[model samples]
Target: METVIEVQGLTKSFGSFKAVDHLNFKVAKGEIFGFLGANGAGKTTAMRMLCGLSKPTSGSARVAGYDVQLNPEKVKQNIGYMSQRFSLYDDLKVEENIRLFAGIYGIPRPLIKTQTEALLEKLHFTEERNTMVRALPLGWKQKLAFSVAVFHQPKVVFLDEPTGGVDPVTRRQFWELIYEAAAQGITVFVTTHYMDEAEYCDRLSMMVDGRIEALDSPQQLKEKMGVASMDEVFRLLARKAKRTE
Candidate 1:
């Protein structure tokens, strides 16, 4: 497996507080890697460092073959990001938002039209292309945001709590999209609080108190921790955490 994301002693701090402490991990190409943790476990802080949205106070990370500190812009260009909050423009129509993001990613003009139609069709959203994003259901917006994030064909896509506040059915549907993206060789690095969602990942790194407390395949972690489910494994590890949401 080709390593698409590599980190060594990655750390982040704010004033006297350490948000991420000496983290080290690697994600392979085409992986659905879960960076799992409770709220305030520094998952978002660590994610921002990896996405090049924030610099690490110490240590190093290389995302998509570019050193994060040295080539933040290059790292940003090679990776797609969807934050915990809805990030698309609600005022823009469905098709307009698609075209706008494609342009931002510098997708060629001729291909944008073709790809835009294909995306809408895939989402069963062809008829609502002219409808404003604000008019759509939350589920529809989540689907569209994810599709746009990966439409640029980035080497990696970071999803921060992407399934929050959705019905279980809708969340499962979103995971299907994640599976499809992974199948096409887009490495997915996702931070999620839902242990059920964590089960969908190829492997997971459990974060507790700004550090990786455990890292392994779900089955392996379960066996090692003497647990039957990812939820149990998470609870056991998270018990050691000093942070709270």
Candidate 2:
């Protein structure tokens, strides 16, 4: 498979503090890549740089074949993002939100209607098309937010803690959607606090103290660390952080 995202010696600094230190990784096309980390581990910062939301202090990253620093706009065009905050207009109806994102992603005006209908139908949201986004249940809102993020059919989608605060059933359903997207050739880059979720990825990278401390398939990581599960692997690695001292 083709490499869709490449990071080489990527670093980001906030004045005297380093948020991402000499990071390096690559994400393959259509692969589900999980990025795991405890709070302040720099997962968000690294993802922000990859998504072109923040500038890197040194080194380089190519996302969807566009240099993050040199071609931020082009990079943005080829990627979708669903933030942890569930970015959507609360006051807007479901259909309106879908149309809004379709326009923002530069989808042709003529195709927006068809695309919106298809998306609503696929997610079983056709009945709620006219309902205000804020009126929907939390799980429905989350699913809708994800659908809107990927509606433009970008090559890669960044999901930042996409299932935060959701019930187990909702998370399971959300992962099903993720699998469907990956099957259709969209590379998934996700970060999550849940170890169970981490195990579902094709591969995972665990970050500690602004650097990736472990990068491997969950099974490999478990074997390498001599652990029985991702929860144990994460606990052992995360405990090594200096802040935990």
Q: Rate the local accuracy (lDDT) of all candidates.
A: 0.94, 0.94
Q: Model 2, 1-245: lDDT tens per residue?
A: 79999999999998978889999999999999999999999999999999999999999999999999999999999999999996999999999999999999999998999989898899899899999999998889999998888888889999999999999999999999999999999999999999999999999999999899999999999999998999999999999898541
C-alpha RMSD values across all candidates: 0.9, 1.1
TM-score of candidate 2 versus the correct structure, residues matched by position:
0.98
TM-score of each: 0.98, 0.98
Candidate 1 residue spans exceeding 4 A from truth: none
Candidate 1 lDDT by residue in tens digits, 143-165: 89999999999999999999888
Error of 2 at 90 (Å): 0.2
Query: What's each prediction's clash count?
Result: 0, 0
C-alpha-based local distance difference test score of model 2: 0.94
Clashing pairs in 1: none
Q: Which ten residues in a row have the lowest lDDT in candidate 1?
A: 236-245
